[model samples]
Target: MQKLTINLALITPLIFVVMYIIPLGLRDLWSPDEIRYAEIAREMVSSGNWTVPTFNGLRYFEKPVMGHWMNAVSQLLFGENNFSVRAASVFSSAGSALCLWLLVERFITRQMAWISTSIFISLFMVAAIGTYSVLDSMFSLWLTAAFSAFFFAFTADNSAGRYKNYGLAGLFCGLAFLTKGFLALLLPVIVVFPFLLWQKQFTSILRWGWWVIAIALLVCLPWGVAIHLAEPDFWFYFFWVEHIQRFAATNAQHSEPFWYYFAYLPLAILPWLFVAPTAIRHLGKHLNLPLIRYALLWAVIPILFFSLARGKIVTYILPSMVPLAILLAVGLSSAYQKQTRGFKWGSVVNAIVMALIASAFLILYYLGYLPLEQGEHYRPWLAFTAFSFWALFACLAIRTTTLEAKICCYSMMPVGLFLFFWASIPNLSINSKMPAAFIEELKPYVTEKTILLADHPSTMSALNWYLQRNDVYLLNSKGELEYGLSYPDAADRFITQQQLAEFIKTKQNNSTLLIFMRGSALPETQLPGISKRFQRGRFSAYYFAKDTSHD
Candidate 1:
């Protein structure tokens, strides 16, 4: 036991360092989502208003305030960089992995617990999303912790202990709700209620279910009530437009086919992808067990629920990872015990797949299918990493005799992924849609006195973050920002093309006016004396000097 404790102490930090910590601040915040969330948190911290979330000085209410609040706190402590902004998610993800270890340890062997937790963290989607500055990882963490706590509470032999566990479950559920809203509560209900019915625990559920609901509401009510009191229509907008309309209407523009998530699930858990079918079969053989039954329901119900919803995205199915990891751990454990042929063949197949992908990239580069400049820059690193993974897996396939060794081999996959990501960092920065350098070039022209105008602000969300100021004028734009702009205080920030032209013509001689628009949207006739100053990617910036003559 002492040795086990020491091993865990050493392993925990090691996992964190490899999975979350070392990669911190290595990449720029990607556009559209990462930058938007980071900037909102920045605005929150700068404005000293925590109740209502704002993006680019507009009252943004697309998401709940918990993520923004956590991010603001991170920035306060870490001084506002990519690492600081993403720190909340990184810690939350690590916390979730720890919780998974503890939860599994309660019901299974400690070795199995460690294996399950490792598998959970190693999955491609889990590691990738956890490192990014997004709310989904935090939400998934809270939801998984809540479910795990509830499972413990529900399965407890003692009545008093069961109620206490219910309280913890409620608290975590409430935290989850704060992270992402009603879906948190909805998912738990969908997962747990069916398990209760299947177990015929009607009396037990009837006795404690209301307590769970009451505690969750108690924990969640303060923020909900506060937001409602501050904005009378907040509840309507949050529940109706953000939740109901988002799910029911495609007009929100996030439309994808119903099969999107189904197709994505296999890839999301890649490298372990070949083992999934065998895991499912193993799960079917053990369905009679209460824990296995719960795992099955936990995994399947969310996929079906999200598949039925009109709106879909890749991360919506993150909650399923918990149960999927549990099932995979069980399957792998059994494979080790029984020397299953499936495990052996699956490892071989994974190796072949890796080799094929790596060879294809090398072939493409040689044949000129890839850009010669970038390809030449990336080829050596890509070749080394890919071939290395292929060789490692191939060796394990050919030489490994024990299932224990095979499971150990799987751990290297995530390490290889991070190494590849680290190697590709330079290329990713160059190819990123966000104009980090371009914005840096515009810094001299942007000042407190400068009048900045964006032809369509919605398309260039990264500008809000890089510019670090929200006083820019928008000309002819409406989308996600529409909600924030609809409020009376933000009306003046929006201007028409004619209004922008007039402002340019009549601006004070001491003040400079800059216009940023898409390359295609640049007017055929330059605005009198406005001269194009910078052009990068799809965006172009024009400078209107105070003393320049009109055309």
Candidate 2:
């Protein structure tokens, strides 16, 4: 036990450093949710509205307060930047590693525990999203924490008193709920209990379990009730509509085929790809190894659950990666112990081949040899190259009859470190350039008290966030012109180009600037009160002058 604790202490620092020091290149900055969520959190802090999250100064309650709160706190402490926002994910990822270590120590051998935790931290998806500033990273971390606490509670010597660990488990679940929502509570029961029951340890259920559950509810209900009371629709939209109905029904916009997760499986697992079969085989052989069985259940059940789920985002199966790493680690590490020739050569060759393929592709991508549609797809290309190289490096350790072979087989640490620094961190650096340009262009007009308005508002969320203001006016097509200018909401205050023309005919204010979509169908001959037009990326700004008004 002491040795296991020491292993955890050593592994904890290493994982934390890996998560903390990794580069956050501009990989997916403008990708719908990542930057948007950060920007919303920034706006919430700037606007002083902790009750409801707003995007572009509108009631945007798609997700819960956990992520937004993290963002707000991050911005408060470090200023509103990618590094600050992403720190939440980094801490959560480290917590996940620590949780895995604790879980393995309790259920498996000390060596297996280390191996499992190491592989988990090194997983492509976990490494990719974990190091980034996104909700999934934190969500997965909390999910793991909850599950890990539950596992220890469930499998611990009941005579030793289980309530403490069980309560901790519930607390972690509550934390998860805060991070993402109810998926936090649903995940452990659905995923873990089936495996425990399959083992026919029905009597294995302990007394203090209810307390953990009660704590989870205790932590979750207050915020949920507050939101429900404050915005009754908020609870309905978030809990039932988003969680249950979205999963139960189709068409919440996040839809993928049942096989979608299957396609992502290899990529998600990455350097462990070659050892997947062996891991499955080892899982079957060691059914009595409660940790291995639980890990296997953990790995496989989420895939099945998500594959059947209507919402099939890649991160949906994130919690499963923890178990996958454990299963793979046990498989490869145990195979090394078995001294099998086929296992040794096959794994090494596979790694080398995968790495060579990745290196070639990366070289091509860097040289512009591979033509992609846009910059966003760079994730897949980068992931492939990084995973391949790591797999190759790991293969080098797999020699005929040497402990070094085993070490080589699991060389995900360096690979994860390199990708975290070279790939994931730097990804944000690349994406921040365009937004930086927009911010620079808009800076001259923006003042401490400027009432900035954009037609889509989303076009300016990043801008508003960067400028650290919540006063951006979103002029989308919502009905408000009917009030005859007595009063208007933010949505109605936006005068259409047609409205702008009429207003020019009425008042002749030529200096008014109208920001419109580049392809919007504004008739040129409606009113000849156009002073100038400027185009920037996907948006166009028209400076309408009253002098040229000649309908």
Q: List where candidate 1 sits over 4 angstroms from the true fold.
A: 1-13, 250-252, 372-376, 383-387, 422-432, 455-460, 508-510, 517-519, 524-526, 547-551
Give the CA lDDT, 0 to 100, for residue 497 in model 2.
59
How well is each residue in 349-386 modelled by candidate 2, as lDDT tens digits? 66766667667766766776654435445654665656
lDDT per residue for candidate 1 within 343-401, as digits (tens), equals: 76787788777777767766776676654353446754565575567447645744566
Q: What is the C-alpha local distance difference test score of candidate 2?
A: 0.64
For model 1, name the residue pairs that clash: none
Worst 10 residues of 2 by lDDT: 478-487
Question: Which ranges in model 2 have alpha carbons more than 4 Å from their true place?
Answer: 1-20, 25-28, 203-209, 342-395, 399-434, 448-458, 475-551
Best model number under TM-score: 1
